[model samples]
Every structure is written in C-alpha cells, then in structure tokens.
Target: MKAAHFYLLLHVFSTASVLVNAFDPITTTVVVSVGAALGRTIYDYFHERCDPKWISFNVTGLEVDLENKLFGQHIASRIILKAVNGFMSNVNPKKPLVLSLHGWTGTGKNFVSQLIAENIYKEGMDSSFVHVFTSELHFPHPSQLDTYKSQLQQWIKGNVSNCERSMFIFDEMDKMHPGLIDSIKPYLDYYDKLDGVSYRKAIFIFLSNAGGESIIQTALDFWKAGREREEIELRDLETLLSLSVFNNKKSGLWHTSLIDKNLVDFFVPFLPLEYRHVVQCALAEMEARGLRPDQSVADQVARDCVYFPKSERVFSVKGCKTIESKLDYYT
Candidate 1:
C-alpha cells in the first residue's frame, strides 16, 4: 500500500508541474500581444504622416496647349514637353528624366518649371510631389555643405522611395554649392536599384544662369549671321552649353559626374526673348489682370526693358520678368 501511494504521488506531482508550465503567465502573454499591437500602430501612424500619396498623372491636351503658349523657347519647350510626356506614359521606366535648363534671367526657366508642375500635378504649384529647392533658401551657407549633402540625399531618397514619380526642381542651381549639387549624383545614376530605392521614375530639373552667356552668344551669332530664330535648334548649342556649364568653376554642377556621364538627358536652352515675345508676355499679363490688352501699351512695356548690344537693335533683356509691373506705368 505504501509503494502504490508513493507511485500515485509521483504521477500527481508530474501532472501538476506540466500544468504549471503550460499556463505559466496569462498576464505576460497579454502584455506581449498588447505591446506588439501598440508598436505596429505607432509605426503605421508615422509612416502615413511621413509618406505622401502619389497619384498617377496623365499628359493631357491642356498641357500641350500650355507648352505652345510658353514664349521664346520653341526648341526647349518642345523638348521638355516631349520628355515629360514620354516619361509619364511609362508606369515603370528604366531611367529618370533629368533636364538642365540653362538660360538668362527671366527667360522662363522658372516659369517653364512651374508650368510643368501646374499641368502634371493635381495640386498645381501646391503639389506635395513637386518639390522646389532654391539655392539661397535651401542651402545658403558654405559651412553647411556637409549638412546639406546629407539632407539632400535623405530628402531625395525618402521622397523618391515613397513615390517614384516625384518631381524635384532645383532653382538657382548655379548658386548652390558645387558639393551639395554633386551629392545628388547617386540618385541620377543609371542603376536599376539604389539603396532600397528605385529612382528610375523620378524627374529632376536643374535651372540656372550658368550657361546663359553661351546661349545668348549663340543666339546673337545666329541673329548676326541672318539665321531665322525659328531655325535655331537645341543641337545648335547643346555641346557648347554642356561644356560651358561643366567647365565653369562657379557652376553648381562643376565637375559633376552627371555632366561627365551624359546622364542629363536634355540641356534645354532658353534663348533670350526678342521684342515680339515680350509683347506677347505683356498682353498675356494685361489680360490676366482683367485689363483689355492694348498694342501700344505692350509695345511701350517691351521697349522700356534694357537690352544687350546697345549698338544694334534692342531686344527685351529681362524677358517679361517686370512686364507686369511695367504695365501699370503704361496704363
């Protein structure tokens, strides 16, 4: 009887131990599940806050009309529109669309970029996907070059990784630190994958006055040689403009691999506007202001702008930048 009782006690003890192990701590299990739930919720909240929703855009007839309406950049305008249209058509492209717009002040470099943003995005200038970085505003100090470099890289990677179709416009690129500009080279690379980011569907536009002189001189040469302004092709100045932008030490992209690799698909030159284009601008502004555009007013506004080659006939030097402001004087 004692032996049987001992065996029974042993079995009971073993069963109790197994039961204890199986249900060790219900509270611990509940706490772990709740912790995991909270962590996921926090992660989701930040992810939604940080990453914007990007809508697929289509090239519409209205955009084409706007391109035509842009004055004095016949070849450049066509090239920009064609590249954007083609890029937008492809849902997943193998490469990004990189365009460098080089020209004189007020020749519509910024204006063209804005027009593109307005047409391509539903939010127009306020689109979250359209990021415009100005040199003086975004990266002003030379001492902050390294900081800007890291910030720029993160900004590009973050935005592009979230939405590959994002558009980045860097205005006054001629004034940005060369090092800061060079920091963006990796994003423009021909790689299919880069650091968990695919930048093939992104669009980058660099606007600057770096190659303005070369472009203006080329146009002047064509003018003096009796070549029609309509006959001017971007190929006429592409090689020279690229060389000028790259070789110039003051250029934002000085010695950039992007320039060396021919990675920039287009160097769209905004030629200096002639007197006629300025008149078109004045009329457009007047119409926009609810004033009936007058031919004499437009002519006077164009005439007031200072021009180069003072010995020869004058052209609109500022290309309608101040045309709207000057219209008040005429009216």
Candidate 2:
C-alpha cells in the first residue's frame, strides 16, 4: 500500500511538472495540473476501466423515465436514446458520434442533453470528461473569432487526447457566429488522423433553435390534418430540418464544411410540446421537488403556459422551458 501511494505521487508529480513546463500561463498550467489529478483520482476509483454497473445500467429504464419526464416528442426521445446506446456500445469507433439537436426555445433540447450526460457520466453534468460550451459563455465576442477558433481546437484536441471518450456539448449553437464552428471540422473529420489527435471515440452534441419554426410547422400541419402524433417519424422531417440548419445564416455551422462533408451522424428534432406535455413537465418538476403528484397543480401550471398560433390552438410553443417557474408559482 505504501509503495503504491509513492508510485502514484511520483506519477502525478511527473505529469504535473511536464504540464507546468509546457504551458506558460499559470492558470492554464494549474488547470492542467488539476485535470491530471482528477484523472488520477478517477483512474484509482475505476481502476482504469469504465464502471460496468454504471455503463450497463438498464438503458430501457432511462428511456422510460425520460419519456415520463419529458412530455410528448416520443419519437425524438426514442431516437436519441437508441443513438446513445449504439454509440456507447462501440468500444472504439472510427468516426465520432455527432448529434445535432434542433428545436424551439424550450423543446427539451438542453434538457435532453443534460439527461444524456447525467445517465452516462458518473458525475452527471459535472463530469470532468463532459465539457459544455454555450455560445454566449465561451465565445461571446465575434471579434475574437480567431482566438476562439484556436482555443476551441486546442481544447478539443487536448481533452480528447487525455480521454478519448470525452463528450462535448455546445449549446446555443444558433447564437454562435457563422464560420466559427468550422474550427472543429478537423476533429469531426473522417480521415481518422487530424493533428495526431484521434477524435473518433469522442461524442459531439450541438443544441440549437435554428430549425424550430420548420419543426413546429410540420407538427402543426400534422395536427391540423388530424394525423396521429405517433405517425410523425424521423423520415417525415429529417431532410427539412437538416436543410434549415445548414441554410440558416445565424447558425454556427452555416455554410461550413461540417454539414457539406456530412459528418453529423444524426439530426434529432425536438418538436413543440402540447398542453398535456406541459402538464407532464409540471408533474416532473413536482416530483423533482419531492412533492406528491397533484393533478390539479399540474393542470393549473399547464393552463398558465402560452401556446403558439393565436388563430389555431397548438401546444406549448416554448415546450417546458418556463413550466418549472410556473409550477413553483402555482404550487
């Protein structure tokens, strides 16, 4: 035990020394040191292997709970769940699993992303291997495009090199400047070798409201035509969603080679939530708060939500975005 502790200290110190010498900024060096330490801690906990009990936990249970938790959009939930299972099943993939989630303001894009991270990562959203970058938070200034580009690339490369199974989530992709997302093209490239970084094992997720209008329109059309919501399959809206995302000038990947190269594995569309979905969202919030389920409160919260299309009554335009606050206010 003493010898093992000594070896661990020696290894950590040696790695920290290398990082300190390589990075000039004390902050960057410190971050690298901390990351190294965390990596060692995680390694010691799992003994250099992923926790099987955690990884192999019943995904079906996750799917069922997500279905109950996230109101409506059953198709989207199933598709995403299946994709996650498939991607994680691969021990080492040749190409990274890239998922672009497109929908409206509160259509569960961010919520579902968090769900995925939480289930797969032991630390949930706080997992060191999971990195989230919001447009306004990380690359707020358009003028710093060049700096952001280099920094983004280096960040991905460094993290992936450290842990190939790293997951990268980019939120508010619509708010990101055009041409900036291309900086990540090399990592998402199919060549298998980019700047000596093997990005194949990494997972990339982009959340955006770019194709919200189109998705809502499709759903509205279906509803008006008296078509069952269950019939709306991925085939019904995949092309239009992808085109809208690529054509939208405000999108980060607008006119970028990432779309042209067809690197994105799946374009999951989160449709607008209905009144019933809002009620479910309310119930979910209530359950999360450890409060007993109350149909009256759920109905009240759902009624308080604003729906879209003033002329024609549709579902909650913002999905469950504001339902929590409303639930709190009501209950």
Candidate 3:
C-alpha cells in the first residue's frame, strides 16, 4: 500500500511537471491557437448536432451542444409517435403524413417543431416524413404556387394513394395565396371514401398564423379606423370578406371584428401554450444546461417581453413584483 501510494504521488508529480513545463513560449502560442481552432471545431460539431441546430450560444455563456445535451429528454418524440399511430390506425392504407404549422400572436411554431424533433431523435428525425417549412417567408415564385398545387395533387394521386389521412401542417397560411386554399379542397374528405376508392384514410392539416376571429377583428379595426380616418371601407372590407364567409355579418359570424366563423373553421388554429409557458420552457432549458437564472437577465427578459417564466414561479413572480414596486407611481 505504501509503495502504491509512492508511485501514485510520483505519477502526479510527473503530470504536474509536464503541464507546468510542457512548451516554450512559441510552442505554447502555437498550441493555444491550435487548441482554440480545435475547440471551435468541436463547438461547431455539437452545434450542428442539436435539435434546433440553431442554438449557437448558451445561457451560461458556454457553448451549446445539441447532440450531447439533448439526449432522451426531447418532447417532440411523443407528438410524432402519437401522430404516426393516429394516422396508421385511422388510415386503412396508411396515408402520407402532412403536419401543418398554424398559430397566432406569440406562438412558438418553430420551437414546437424543435421540441418534438428533439424528443424523438438525439440527432434529427428523417426529414423525408417531417418537413419544417416556414409559412412567413414562403413567397411563391411567380407561377410556382400553381406548380406546387399541381405537383402536390399529382403526388397525392400517385404516391399517397394508399394513405387514408395525409397530415399537412401549414404555418402563417394567411401569407399564402388565397387561391391556394381552394387547391386542397379535394383532400378534405377523410371519413368518406373518395369516389370508387374503397378506404377511409388521410389527414390534411393546415396551420396558419391568422385565426378566424383575429383576422376579422383586425379587419374590423381597420374598417373602423378607416371610417374615422376617411379611408375606403369598401375596399378594405372586400379584402376581409374575400377570405371570410360572412358578408356584412351573416349567420353566427359577427362574434368578433376580424374573421368570420366559416374562415375560422377552415383552418383550425392550434392554440399556443401561453407566453409564460414559453419563457418557462426557455428558463427550464437554460437551467438544465447549468445556467442558474440570474435576476438581472431574468428581469430584463421579463421586462422586454412581458412574459413571466412560470416554471420557477417563486423566482419569476418575486422578481417581477419587486421590479414593479420600484417604479415611481403617478402622483
């Protein structure tokens, strides 16, 4: 035991000596540069491997890594599994899965997709079945909208013949051409078999940023403002009416000022988990990565966004209230 201890001490001494006198100044400089390059390379590697693949920085001021950090705790895995099962069960002959992205103000459409992807895949889900397209910037290239319709219809007829339900998730669908809405009218049938096709199958999901009522409300606001400002109400209402079913208030449509009931039903909006929920998730994610929430940063984030993190209620509520109390009240 004494001899073993001696050897261990000697080994430790040798390691210390090696570290202390490893390199000359020039050699040390070269080594540091090389090490920095290697560090950057490793960081890049991890960054690419993350679920979002977009998080380059960490809350703790350290490098963020997806492949290393996002193991076994991703949330999206369950969603896809359930969606797959639902599609498989309801579909007599397994239809192509089409998931849409739709939500209104403060919705985390991209983040939701990332969570689902991270849950299932430590790396990334095979994107063939999963497409993450942003509706915000997808301005159709000239006549490409027509081309997309034709090709999609063709694909549906040819490849997706066996699929009972096709799941298509579209986000910010309001940005898409109005005519594009009419294109997918054929696939609306899920329970009823199409003509001679002897199967009940397929899910078509269209996620949009514009909700039924919000759009109506926004338009109404515009119309009201226009009336007040002496602008053209007819043209503005025409644009709103173009998308909605209610024309100057119809059967059960005048609930809100922005959108009609029929248009609301057309693209069912997937309600977002609240802003507080989003901040909570982000905070939790940061905490999981070893960044203890500092009051200064948390306060700034809360103040900037008005979103209190609910995951750590004690922290968020206390911090927000404290900050609020500091502000001078009006006389």
Candidate 4:
C-alpha cells in the first residue's frame, strides 16, 4: 500500500481496537478522529516542498562584535542602530517614514544600509518607522555633478513626505566633488542634510574611501617600490579612505588634488569619527562574505586604511598607551 493508505489503515485498526475497549466512548471517538485527520495534513505539509530561507534575528548565530575593532566599540552597528532607533523611537502608530542610502565604490556601504532598514522595518511590511523608498543611490560621473545633483534633489523631494528622523547616507562619498554636496540644503523637509545631500530625520552621512591621499600615496609607493601596472587600481574602499588625511592643517583636502576647488574644504572634515565605522564595517563585511583579500598583496592597501588616525587618538591597550599596537597591526 502507498504511505497514505498504510497510515489510514493503521489508524482505522487502532481506532477500532480503542473503541472496542474505550471506557469513555464519547472522548475516544472524538480524539481518534482528530488524530487521523492531523496525520494526513502533517504528511502532506512535509512531503517534498523546498525549505524557504527566511532571514530573522535568530538565523545567524554569529553574534555581532559590538566593540570589535580599533576605531572604537560598536562603530559599525552604531551607525545602523542610530538611524533605525531614531526611526523606531519616533514612528507614529499612524504614519510612514523613509530611508535613502548612497554608495560610491568598494566599501560595501550598501550592505549596512540594508541591515538597518531590514532590522527596524521588519516590524511590519506596510507600517514601520522606516521604508526603503529608494534602496540604492548612484551618482552620475564626477564631471556631470550638476546633472546627478538635479536628479538627487528631485528624488529626495519626491520620496520623503510627512515623517521625522529619516536617514540619508552617502557611502563612498569621497569620490564625488564638493559641488555635489550642495544638492541637500537644510530645509523643513524630512531628509537629513549633510554637506548638501538629504535623507530623512536630518542625519546626513558621508562614507569616505577613508584616506584618499594616503591610499594614493601607498598605491604609488607600491607601484614605484615597485609592482607592475596591473595592481595600481585597488579592489578595496577602506584602504583608499584610510590613505587620505582626515585633517587639513598640513596638506589641504585630498580631493583638492583631483578637483581644483578653493572652498575651505570642511565638507570632508565636518564628518564625525563615526565615518571610520564605515571603513571597519566594510572590512568585517568582506570577511563574512568569504571574499579572500590577499593580505600580503594588500599590505600597502591596509596600511593606507589606518593612516588617518585623528590627533586626539592613538593605539592603546587596556591600561596602557602605545604606538606598538599600530606597529603590530602593520607588521
């Protein structure tokens, strides 16, 4: 007999035997009938369907290292949490909010954008503190900043309406010129405006390549010291951001070398230490995805990544201060 027929026959025999001896006929009849129906349903449900991979909080057992790296504790998760928490904290029971994220290249800044939005927005598909009104933001070529700027302005003005604490993140923002920065000006609009781009809730984020100049310097040094032309263009973003000097007292903004701008150049500097989180997060993400970065080959690249430590900060161990940690990292 087939599996279903066998199950039905066995259940019928068991029920007949139970009824023959059942002390309480009313309860036994009801119970045996329910068991026969449930078994058939369970078999049909589990027989041969593909298991769906639904992502949820309990899915990944790898607990996030909140304080995992040097720039400070919980740097990456904080940027995500800040935007999400801000939205969740103020979401009215009756309204909707929006999130906008932009990325330049290499940093995988787009990944974190998804994480923040997914975690908070999961509360409900249609009603949550945040929404992915536009998930990916792309800048036009650096030469045509105005064209892209006009497009961005229209996108922001159109998507965000009637909400508070919206977030706009410009990932790998270091690539574009300062001119694009003006697209987002402070207004009563929901977007978070920084430099000139906008997102909701007014918390504008610009994720740099890290140290533009330093990365360039190291890349040049690697080329001259010397590798062939094949390795000049690096495949990593944090390494590029780390090479650029975050301060301007000595060498002016790194982009100035690429673009002939005469502004005070606070566009890059005004960003807080959290920007480095973008770099660290970028690194952690690569490891998670099993994208093998050749460390020896990337030594120059990694060197450029951490070259932009602020004046007030240095490598230190618990209860001790030292540059040895920095040396250890490079070595």
Candidate 5:
C-alpha cells in the first residue's frame, strides 16, 4: 500500500486500539506498539519532504544557542543572528542567503554552521535538504576540476529542485580549487529562475581558514594596544577580510566572481579565543558529556593549549579545538 495510506491506517489503528484496552489489554498493547513502530518508520520515510512539518526557522532558538554555546565571538554572533533572522523572516528573498565564515581553526565556524542548521531543520546536519561539501574530500583533484564542476552543478540543481529551502555548506574552502566554487555562482545570483528552478530561498554557507591570519593580526594589534576585544567590530575586519581572501591565492575565493560580484552577503570573522574562553569551552565540554564542571580541570585544559605571541600568550593557538580530547585525558 502507499506509505501515506499506510500511515493513515496506522493512525486509525492506534486510536482504535486504545478503545480495545477495555476488552483485551494485552492485544491492545501489542497493536499499539506495532502501530507506533510502523508510524516511526513512516515518519522517517517522509522526513526529507519540504514542508512546515519538517522544516521551520526558529530565530530565538538560534540566538540562544549562539549566545550560550558559542564563546568569544560577539561580532560573529550578532552578524549571524541578524543576517539569518532577516533572511528567514522574508517571504520573498531576492537571492539565496550567502554567508562566508572565516576564522582560525576551532574558533566555532563549524559550530555556528551546526547551530544554524539545527534551528532551521528538525534533523539539523542530518537533514537530507542540508548538504555539506568538503574541499579536500569532494574536490581533492585539481585535474578533475571540469568533472567536479559538472557534478557539483548537477548536485546543487538536483537538491535545490527537490527543495527550495535547501541549505549548502562548503567546508575547508581554503583548500578548494580556486575556480571550482564559481560553478554555483548562477544559483547564488538574483535570478528568478534558472531553467524553471527557483534558488532564491536556498542558503549557502562557506567555511574557510583563509583570511584567518589577517583576523589574528588585527586581534593581536588590538590586544597589544590594550583595547578590549569587544571594541573590535566588523567594520575593522570586513574590508580587510575581503581583501585578504580575494588576494590570497590559496583561498577558494581568490579572484572568484563570488567576491567580485558581491554575492557573499556576509564575511563573518571568528576571532581567536582567549585563555578564559578556552576554559569555558573545557567546562562546557565536560557538562555536555554529563560530567560535573570542574574548574581545576578546565583550568588545566586551558593551560595545556598552546598560546600565541610566545611572550604575551594572549590568544589560544588551537582555539578550543582540542578541548574535547584534552578533557578525555584529564577526566
């Protein structure tokens, strides 16, 4: 039988089984249990379908996650919350929401992406409507650029066609072949439709380590001058970040039309974590693993992380990336 018909039959059986409990409790229990298992199977089968039941944007949840779970990124947190809120709230966006997150490793680029995904789709990263591409894994061969471009275009077109609200995330963009990303430029553009498919409602996120050096240098400069890191804003880093990413040969964005055409809606910068932030990460990890937050353990883990500016040691070199493993060793 059709899945939907089966689902409806199971729903009726579950409701009717509840009534049977008065006559035969054991039979009713078995019927209810079997109905529930089949119902779950049916739910998973249709989970990927594009509809309000499966996908809904929760702006407040996203804000809370970014504020509570994310550490040491006031600028990134604010920009992402606003950008995503505005985009999801709009019924008719001119183009797809494009976010290019740049930062040193472990500074929460990937984490922020996960938060966004969780808030938008019930299944988060596991949602079929959400797609992720890694540079080294997906497009490791420069010689296969032509083949990769064709496959990528088809992949995106196919997925977007399946669901207008699909999300695409590209990780390790710095290692991506320079021209490979340009393949999706048309989809990110403001075109109403390309061959009868509307991509305006889709979202594209690019995460990269490119332009991180400039971000670190700026943060370092601010620290050296004794200015509060919170005082540093997007204006101080946005322009510099775009220039650095565009000029850096290894950055997947180098000389790409994505930057030149202003297709990237935001170039969010994640600042390096400080000693205190690393400690917070350690504590948070312990709590996540159901362990009591130990200040001593957090402190030891923070101290174990290598810090930069050899003499000053102002910022974490790994940026809380190794906190989980370190916590394992300590606890």
Candidate 6:
C-alpha cells in the first residue's frame, strides 16, 4: 500500500487501541465504532462514491453557465435555472424531475444538459450515474420495440437502484419508436416505489426537434412585429410546444402517457439562432479550443453558415450546429 494509506490505517488502529485501554469496556466499544465510521468517511472522501461527496448541486455554476456559455436564449436560461434549482433543492420530489427540451438543433438543448451534469456530477457527462440514449443508435429497430422496452426498463431500474440521483438524457426523441418510451412510465409517475425502487430523486431529460417549427414560427412572428426576442416568454410557447409534440406523429412523445399523465414538468423551447448568436458560438468554440478570441475569424465562421428567409436571412439555417467545423475552416 502507499505510505499515506498505511499511515492512515496505523493512526486509526493506534487511536482505537489507546481508547480501548483508557476507557471502560462499553466506552471502548463505542469509541471503536465511531472510529470505524470516521475511517469509512475518510475513505469515501478520498475515493469516488455515489453520495454527496461525488454529487453536489451548484446552482450558481449552472446560472453562470446559462448566462455566459449559452447565447440568445433568455427564456430557456430563465426556466432552466428556476426548474433545476427548485427540483434539486427539494428533499422529496413527487416524481422524477422530467424536462423535455424542444427546439431546432444546436439551440443549446444538449449543452444545457451538459451544464447540469457538470454541476451535479464530479465526472460530468462521464459520470457512471449519467446515461445518454440516442434513439437512432440505441433503439433503431422499430420492430423490436418490445425488446427495447424491456432493456430500457432494466437499464433505468438497475442504474437508479445503484444511485437515486441518476440522470438519463434521451436524444433524438423524434426518431424513437412511439410507444417504446412509455415502458418506463411507472418510474416517472408519483409512487413511493415501483417494486422496491424509488425513482423520485432521478432526472429525465428528453431532447427532440419535434416542436422546432412552432418555436421558429413564434420567434419569426415576434421578429416581424419588431419585438425583441427577449420579450418572448415561456407562456407564449409552452402550450404550443406541448401540443405540437403531442400531435406530431413522428415525435416519440406522440400521445405518450409521459405527457398525458402530466409527468413532464417542463417543455423548454430553444429558439433558432440568429447571425449574432452564431458568431458568439464561433468565438466560444475558439476559446474552448485554447485559441485567443479573434473577431475577424468569428465573423468569417459565422458568415459561412447558411441563413434562412433568403431575402432577409434573419436566422441561421443550422443554428450553431456547424460552428465548430466552420471555425476549423476559418481558423
């Protein structure tokens, strides 16, 4: 063993030995028990554990990330902060904290999830407690929906059994088999336990482009009326988002009970990115790559992206999705 570990063990045993000789039998027993617990705590501190030592909620970090890293998403930034803060602060939640993110690609749906993971898990996305499933890759065979359902349930149950604070992110929900996700409805519902497993402390995030059209339309309408995008609020899009996702047949959430039962707590809308936001993404990517921020390179990268509304070119066609690759070309 390492010298430090050997010394720690020696200290614990020597301290216990001293207590045993100095105190009565009963007192000695209590002291030894306390010593063991302290040793265990020390060990846990040095090692990775599923408890609070490894998982902590940092609302401040999350807030700062949403404000600084994320761009052109006032409504998303606000709802995400409040929703996550409230959910994480609660000692006993009725059900798993469910957030369904709907928007165009690269609108920060995945990035927001990453930020939450980073603040909660010491390992962030690499945490064993955090699981990601891409519908197109994980559950590609629609004909095997039954098998996929079984595997998904087992996966979730087994993981939650290991760590109640587990997080599951489902990407490309629009491509998932319609009824496949409903398999885990029981876990998402308000129940003390489903066959001896409590999922109340878990978090489930669904990412999909199912409602991008409605979200874009809403933003377009605001822009046409010469209203600031910041003026757009959750109230203006929540109902529309839910309806759009529910009615869209291709959406994996299409009439899923996860929605019908009101298990989903929030349907976050990511508005399409404008030219300025794309430029911000480029600059951020540059900084992330350890390069000095160059406005000229950022502008060139942003310019390379295709914009929509041919005449006006108000919004980026691919949002900030291609910013990284485009930046590589310019830089």
Residues 281-313 of candidate 5: C-alpha lDDT, one tens digit per residue: 998898999999999999999999999898989
Q: What is candidate 1's CA lDDT for residue 310?
A: 84
Rank the candidate models, highest lDDT first: 5, 6, 2, 1, 3, 4
lDDT of 3 at 5: 62
Please give the range of 10 consecutive residues that has the lowest summed lDDT in model 2. 48-57
TM-score, model 6 to reference:
0.88
RMSD of each: 15.1, 8.9, 17.0, 15.4, 5.9, 4.9
Candidate 6 structure lDDT:
0.92
Look at candidate 2 and give me any clashing residue pairs. Answer: none
Q: Would you list the C-alpha lDDT of every candidate in the order shown?
A: 0.81, 0.82, 0.40, 0.39, 0.94, 0.92
User: Which one is best on lDDT?
Assistant: 5
lDDT of 4: 0.39
Residue 218, model 5: lDDT of 97
* Model 1 CA deviation exceeding 4 Å by range: 1-58
Candidate 3 weakest lDDT stretch, 10 residues: 55-64
Residue-pair clash count for candidate 1? 0
TM-score-wise, the better of 1 and 3 is 1
TM-score of each: 0.81, 0.83, 0.41, 0.35, 0.89, 0.88
Q: Give the TM-score of candidate 2.
A: 0.83
Output the number of the TM-score-best candidate.
5
| lDDT score for candidate 3 against the true structure | 0.40
